[model samples]
Target: MANASSMKIRVEELESGMITAENVIEPGTERILLLRDTILDSVMIFNLKERYNVDEVYIRKNFSAATVADEMRAEIDIHQSLSTLKEVFGSDEDKPLTEFSKEATKQISNVTNELITSLYADDNILLKMHQLQSYDDYTYKHCLRVAMMSVTIGKSLDLPRNKMRDLCEAALLHDIGKRTIDVDIIRKPGRLTDEEFEAIKKHPQNGYLLLRKNGSYSEEILNGVLMHHEKYDGTGYPLKLRGEQITYLARIITVADVYDALTSNRPYRQPWSVAEAEEFMMGGANTHFDYDIIMAFLAAFAPYPVGDRVLLSDGNKAEVISNNTNVLRPVIKILTGENADEVIDLYNDFKYLTLSIKCLDKDGSTGE
Candidate 1:
């Protein structure tokens, strides 16, 4: 007889004669043994006795835990940076654009580089980055999220370092013009009136002016600010540059902007799920967004995100344990049956079982 601690069972090893335990049943112990086929619901554990009969039972396997502390720390740092930006922007005293000073820019740039390096070290950071809240300081948070998301997508596309930094800077300053807009309109919880929206629409041009006024930013950076809103189909605002006419940095920032807008909760409505937001982008592909950038964005993002619990197609609850080798699907551990507390590698087994993620449970932590 195998010792409970060392006992290993394969999926194929499960059979009618096997007796399972509510927990990890030790050998030579008097724990109740539950029949395999008697299991019901999903992702749970049950004890069975020797007299019980079985036909079929689902058993969950164990999965390794993913370390997400660094990811969470990165998220907190990003949020803090945004908060600082808002405080600096909202002061009653008008600091001249020239007074904006290059030191702060240098500090932001250094932080950006550190953040990119941290995120690249762990793919899990991408999901945690998405969970950042858009507070009253939406402008700063929006800029940071855009910069991070753009860097993520750009790196996935293998853009060179110089170009990626340019993209990051562009994303960071994409909404600098919002400083010139009325705060009430920018933060209004309801649908904007035409005039209000028109005011909001002027941000791109305003941002371009502000950056040019500083006289420190390059034309590449300024162009990114002016054209980030341009759509692939020429339906977007400002200059309405179409498709390839939009700078690559602008195109990248556009996707990031749309993604952050959809995922961050607003006073008007709750944020969309990561999967839902990605689907929205899919619907807009080739029309509102660049197709390849969208693809790269999808590859770099976790729809369900690690650490979030989800209900599986098999009617079981599982925690996302790790990202799958394939970007679209993640590996989850069954947390609820005879398989309760076991890890399931959906990527390896579900191919034959036709299993897929059914729904996400919002209650669980995204683990770090």
Candidate 2:
């Protein structure tokens, strides 16, 4: 039996290498399925779901703060994913989309599987997403970041396994159409001409065509790629489909696509702060994006999750204790001076309303 302190999570939440807190037994017999303190792996998790019909299991929450953060990082190899993407995108320069379809789908599918695994492997999904903010303007990196954000949002909405897998792949390939366009226009430092913007808008249709040509992707994935640019207010390009008229997965990807685009640095403009980018995302909920998906994105893209140490505006240090309703103004415990360990609810407590988080603390110095 799990102790009171052990966190009980659903089977789908299990991560590789997480130690079991208690014995998992077969339903009919007294036979123990897995012993207590068992280090979990993919096979054990699958059997727990399929063979034993286990819905939830207890895991030891004994990792250090640094180790806890590490669980969410480097799930898929960035270099490997980028290398595979470059190979596929390179085909756009030499071979036709048709020529690379099979190999591309196979490799992308493998990466998507790893992406899903990495997402589920930790409790701090937003932390993983937040770490993605510092990425470059490379097409592969942008697509990868978008896929991570979209999947994080999808997980927040409780999307099923198959749908989530489809969503990730769609987001990863949503910008695939850009590969077919001329490199100069895509990377130009100056503002785009109307003709160039129009050409950029064709990416969704182009990506849809490329994936559809493969005949391997699901309709949900294909539609997501085609309609990711569709706005909620019917103002976006291509189909201009609005509201729920857009496919569900496409709607999810739309929020993530815009968020990643805003946060990522460009040739012409600097990257927006995470808080600034999130505010923009929240502002566009009903017009530029789906309201529900935007809400999910907010919930999943916490810039300051609990357990993160931060530097305060007034030159103090604190650890985030909770990320209540307001993502920016979370409950925090001051780590400086006389008020050490005192919890302040930045969103609710009026006494600390004047205070603000400046940035994440690389080192929790007392600001002395």
Candidate 3:
């Protein structure tokens, strides 16, 4: 039997199953029992005849004799409790902000990993865009979106995986300091005074200190929080480190942060169109952002994402149903006077095409 530190079991080994209580066993307790490898694939828990929710179960040295029926019962109880918590805390009415914070942080990490992997393979951008659009709260959604965009940009630039993960973690935690800022300042629907703006600027330091106090994150993560606002031209705040003095991860994150902020609806201003935001970023390149990172970002972002409806230059309407192999061109489903879902491959039909995204609708749906 493998020790807990290096426990190994195949999916087939867990077919018969064994029982182990995650909570009942002490932290250092080392008892081996036959268990389904749920950690390998959490979805497998639903397939098991018996369920256990204590913590985790491990395979034992015995060949084939173990009972997991009781364990499955415990799992059901735990799952029920979790479901209750989700219903109560995740309700639209008035859930506590603390609970929301925890859930948001968890989601940020999960989405960051997904986004990083998606940059290498062009599969899930639409799903991710929809997930981002569904969140009602701006802070959580903004942080998660920025982290995703930053990780995508990093991967497009061919950064190493470990470095990219660190950047993602940093990007996810970048705005955590906002929790320390005054609620009034953060939620203000109008333009702030110079003093209020200064107060808001302190969030990076506040976030860095909060993470430091927690004593769990690495220095690079903290630095990312501290320096993400710094600019290439040395006009940024706090330390004001310019050019190469700022960390590479921080540089990448800054571009992503600004792009998301501009494109996302805020209390003070309507969200800018993706094309408008792209133009703004292009103008800021080399002065506020690293030019190469900007190039990578433009390649990664979809100005007219799939599933969005848009109005073409010819006055006909269409829905963007898919992206072309190249990121610049997308496959749009044109909706003319009588036809719907007429797939138009922009790459092949360039001669007759002069369409552009006017703006993103409230649901991020487009028409052209």
Candidate 4:
């Protein structure tokens, strides 16, 4: 999307004829009250003041509401949640496992509350999460991203508010069992032996037991943590629960967890490209993951959206005009080289079969 020039203003300062540059959401929930480009009138402004807890909104800075298009984009702030997860999940040789469980339970509750609210407001939150690729403190950031994606998938299924809260919390702590394992086995540079791999597969059960002992988490949260590793085809570890036998939240988290792992920058390997990761996820439906959750995953993740300037593998820059049946292979207008301004359908065209997008240019520079 084209991020239109906008300025943030207080709700009390809102005036008639002003246009919203972003979706306005309900406080601490997934409900949306107004969409981007909604022109404000006196009645709408009054309702916002009397009924909603919204404090501020982004409005088009230099254009008339009558003429301006809603080319603006809103994104969730992940840096704060990342910092909080680091605080809860960060390695501290001195911190005891019991203390870590208690602390993580408390902090994750607070962070995921804010995540649910912000994620629903921005339709492109999954794309933003994809851009949060970094190499430092992998576990902390991975858990946070998993929580984000799980909430997004839940929103696509229209999960209830309480279930959404539990889903986010469970996703955040799904790997808590790893803390109880020996550090050597968890961080082994090479492939694990059969015995060591067996120990490694004990994390989900370990996480479930640790949190259940605390008595602070719900059964939904506990089961989600335990069964998140379960597969739809009865091949996963800790338990071979198949199909609907696995909890619904766990199934959702399973899809989110695998996608984040595949795309994350791990110390041992390079991260997969967005296109490759999505293709892999699509191929996992009904075996590695549930078909419905996989569908939600596809609906939530749009690595490339309209108006994005992307770097193609062929050493050219292109502006995404629209996504075809296959979102990763979008119709693009070449912005450089002899074919400048040429629009190519990457999904249907045969000559451009070898070309693919490498990554996006996320410099925050507005106007192509």
lDDT of each: 0.66, 0.75, 0.61, 0.77
The C-alpha TM-scores of every prediction are 0.65, 0.70, 0.56, 0.68
Which window of ten consecutive residues has the lowest lDDT sum in model 1? 35-44
For candidate 1, lDDT tens digit of each residue in 155-223?
889998788777887788788787787767776777899999999899899988877876777887889
For model 3, residues 1-368, the per-residue Cα lDDT tens digits are: 11222233333454433422111221343221211122212344333323423243343333333224433433443333334333322433332223224444454445456556655666444334333432146666666677778877887799898888889889877877666766777767778999999988998888888777766567888888999899999999788889888889999999999998886655444556576888789889899998888888887776766655566666666677777544345677776655566677776677646655444332212000
* Candidate topping TM-score: 2
Better of 1 and 2 by TM-score: 2
Model 1 TM-score on a 0 to 1 scale? 0.65
**TM-score of candidate 4 versus the correct structure, residues matched by position:** 0.68
**lDDT, candidate 2, 1-368, per-residue tens:** 12333567789989775756555666776555664445566877998999889887766677565664355234335546667777767743453343337878998998798789877875444433433333243677678778888888898899999999999999989988887676777767788999998888788898888889889999999999999889999998798898888999999988888887877655445666577888888888899888888878888778775676788898888888889767989999998867888999999999988899988764442121
Please give me the total number of clashing residue pairs in predicted model 1: 13
Which ranges in model 1 have alpha carbons more than 4 Å from their true place? 1-80, 92-104, 117-124, 127-131, 134-136, 187-190, 305-309, 312-356, 361-368
Worst 10-residue stretch by lDDT in candidate 2? 126-135
How does residue 257 of candidate 1 score in lDDT?
96
Model 2 scores a C-alpha lDDT of 0.75
Q: Kindly indicate the candidate among 1 and 2 with the higher lDDT.
A: 2
Which candidate gets the maximum lDDT versus the true structure? 4
For candidate 1, give the lDDT of residue 117: 70
